[model samples]
Target: MTITAVWPISSEQDPNAGDSMTITDPGEIETLVSRLSESTAGAATVWHEGRELADTDTQMHDHDVMALVAEGYGYLSYIDADHDYAVLDGDPASPAWNGEDVDFPKGSGVSPETLAEALREFLDSGERPESVEWQPAEW
Candidate 1:
């Protein structure tokens, strides 16, 4: 199982931009999922091979744990805002993280990188990350 992260890029920003990256390290995948779990306040859905993992929400950071344990690629989506959401694509076999513009159903969306970094640092330092660090993208 190989997981590649793909994001939507706005033509206004870069007409020839391709928003996708490959994540190959299992530790990095864990780091990404851990931060994602913290971002959602531990509220997120876990999917393995495109199927949701059961009994994950009830457990603490289960999404993060399940992702690490998944035999196949893992996908986690967190709805952090009314019109903003974050997604993590992790493959134990092969992984990639994409950075680009993502259009939402509401005609707007934001990049998850800032949030990921903040959460990552928070997890590493045990300090709360500030929301003002980065604002979600809008259209």
Candidate 2:
């Protein structure tokens, strides 16, 4: 659950792009996680002492991303601060990675050329390839 707040900042009209939210109760997180895990989608819930926030172990990196994609679990990955996309490697058993640079969600069985075309199209709304059947977490 997200807490919404509207603080009147006379000097600013809009909130900062990067906003920091404080979650005071650890039990709320557990409750939310439990509710989300009941869905049909694959679920991974982790619990840690509420001593710190954003630990390295919970954060995924390059190789970690490969593993996640290969596992065929649907996930929205934030590749970087400015670039984010959903990726699920075609053939979960193989480490095949293909997706657009911007926000294309590519799944397993997407050809490399098709993936490139999707990325190119995302850049400028260009023509999409006939074979690029890009979908979000369809696998």
RMSD of each: 14.7, 16.7
What are the per-residue Cα lDDT tens digits for candidate 1 across 1-139? 2233333333556665434333444335455544433321222222222223335576333122112111122232333223244433222233332222222222112234433443344334322234313223332
Candidate 1 versus the native: TM-score?
A: 0.23
lDDT of each: 0.32, 0.28
lDDT of 2: 0.28
Leading candidate by lDDT = 1
Error of 1 at 89 (Å): 18
- TM-score of each candidate structure, all chains considered together: 0.23, 0.22
Model 1, runs deviating above 4 Å: 11-13, 30-139
In TM-score terms, which candidate is top?
1
> Candidate 2's error at 50, in angstroms?
40
In model 2, where is the ten-residue run with the lowest total lDDT? 61-70
